[model samples]
Target: MLWTLRSPSVRHLQPCLARKLSFTPNSRLPRITKDAVREIPPSTSFREQVARSAAPKSFTSEIKTPPVRNQVIVFLVGSFAVYSIAAEQCNVETAKWTKKLSGSSLIWKVREPTSEELRKAKRLELGRKLQAGLSSLKDMTEGWSQTMRGLAVWSYIQVFQPILDAGDGKRTCWAIGGVNTLVWAAWQVPKFQPFMMKHFAHNPLSGISYTLLTSMFSHRSFLHLLFNCMALASFGKSSGVAASVHLMKEQAKNPHGIQETDVTWHFLAFYMSAGLFSGMTSHVMTSKVLYPRMIARLTSKAKPVDAAAVAKTSETITETSEKTILPSLGASGAIYAAVTLTALAFPHTEIALMIPPSFPIPIQWGVGGIVALDVIGALRGWRFFDHWAHLGGAAFGAWYYNYGPHMWNSVRATHLEASQKVQRPEKTD
Candidate 1:
């Protein structure tokens, strides 16, 4: 009988009997079946393949961990929920019952109209009416624009209420000039105010060149005057006077005497020149050859039908318009001058503006930027605004700030020399 060893193989040397021995048919030893010992092909079924490829696992088993990806997603979702809830709550509280949020669409709180609120609202409305009526009356008295003057006065009050009852001389001049301009030349007034525009006007021969000091009062609207006055009060009042005084005191101890009145004169010049410069810049641009093209186009009635022709025409018109057709209106030039002077004189002071509401630009940046932009606009032949006036006003302000002290000292010296000569102790001449 043939037997297969299931244990480790051992080398056995049986007595060297016959090489091949056969067991008796009735031997008790168990026989190994060929089927059980036969090799079987690798189990290629899905289950068996998967089992073979799998790594050996310990019986202790593995403990699963929290997924990192899942943790991040959960955190983001939670944060979003908090933000959404906060926004909703704020919106709910801010919602207006009356349904008016100025000129915008945002919801604002509707406060129950209290008696005091009603009274205040009524007073404000009445005050505006009274101001209007008073301005008209004042206009009659002044023989110029009394209404615009009132607005300028109000603006000054608003801006300089913080300083004192008496604020600045330049601001006062600006207010006066604005009133004069509104009544005298009415081309720059906004729609909300009167629009009696200035017509073609000049003396018969050698007409006013606008270089005249009186030309400062030439704005089109009362509002223009108001804005300039406000700027002057806010900026000029704080700095111009203080700087003039400081400079005057400093020069008092010097060999060459200085005059406070001489230094203070530029305050008047700044107010007057800024307005005149802006108007002159606009006038010059308007009078340019190409400006007539823009005016003609703007005033024309019929539209061109040809696409190619229209395109070419539009390009020409744009080029021509940019080359001319600019009118510099408004008191922004003057206001910017005041702002520049104020910034140069008081480098660290903060300024507030009420023009756009809720936001204030820095004085230095605001003044310098306007001047620079005007210069660029003028150089580029832009047709949108009067950049020349802006540059002129700002330049005047800078020059005045730097040289005012010296000029004042020179004037004082001249005055001293004249007075001493006049008061000379002369004997027999």
Candidate 2:
């Protein structure tokens, strides 16, 4: 009985022993099977992971919307401050002139000039200017070679002659156009493109402050410069004066209200203010609204499973924001302000288009059409021009047209009072 039981147990044990003997040491040592061992993936750097993971969905989730500051408020406040300071300086100069003209130490009170006297003086000054301009033209042409003379004459006729013929306000606009031409010329050079785009163009993404001002005088194309200069020349007359559009017709009706002073300071202040306001508007819209939408679109289009696709999507986002969105440079915004102001100031005035050489259309109609077009463009997401900026400028111009003259008068009055106080003689016992 013991032999039989032992034999059965040994038979079972022999099978188990055979199986164990069949397995080699290599097979027993963690069996290096594909599923048994964890294969090491190729080493990738952290930056590469981040760069490759820029799928719109992941990127949007990772990046919170950037905080934008209230640059518009700052620009508005600074504009007023600059205007006040300029008015004060002008009053100070006027006070000095008044004192000089008094010709008596006992005369402490400032004498306000009659409108008739001012008109006579302006006429006399105009005569003197014409005489001087003629003399200079004769002298300039006398010593030039034939080719040089022809070039100079052509330049003067096409450029300098109009500037010379323009009034104080229009002349100032021409000077500004000269600056724009210089910037445009700089844009023509191959090497300067990068520098020009970086410094002269207003890139909302760059977070630069000075570019707001610099970009107002920047134009990349000749047609752009020509159009802007033409508009500026047409509309950029001093308030209460005649221009391409009959601005401030109500003021024109009241001859006494049309006190002509040098409007250089005022025009400069308005132009800069409009440009800054418009730039800030564009910046805010781009940062707050357009950028997120862009990211969303990009994300929707990207394939998350493909690493290469993700990387390409990221590169496209960078290029769109940096190259396409950022480089807004022109005087269009400021010129829009001038245009709207002219339209509102002279509602019945007519203007002719240069491109098509169309017959003169009502100024109000032209402004309305352009503004409406801009509104539609903004709504439809047109990328050719900064429509928001144009709208902002238009709004500013409208606001200024209503309140600007009163504000200017208030500034002048305040400065004039302060000046009178300074010039007043102290009573002696």
Q: Top model by TM-score, which number?
A: 2
Candidate 1 accuracy as TM-score? 0.43
For all predictions, the C-alpha RMSD in Å is 32.7, 11.8
Q: How do the residues 242-353 of candidate 1 rate in per-residue lDDT, one tens digit apiece?
A: 4333443444444552212222343443455445544444444444433444445543653645778756766765565544443334556666565566668766555455
Using all chains and alpha carbons, the TM-scores for the candidates as numbered come to 0.43, 0.71
Overall local distance difference test of candidate 1: 0.48
Q: Give the TM-score of candidate 2.
A: 0.71
**Judged by lDDT, which candidate is best?**
2
Question: Candidate 1, which segments miss by more than 4 Å at Cα?
Answer: 1-164, 167-171, 174-208, 238-255, 258-266, 273-332, 359-361
lDDT of 2 at 310: 65
Each model's lDDT comes to: 0.48, 0.71
RMSD of 1: 32.7
- Model 2, 199-280: lDDT tens digits are 9987777767677778889999898889888878777854332332232232233322433235555666677788888887
Clashing pairs in 1: 139-146, 188-220, 189-220, 189-221
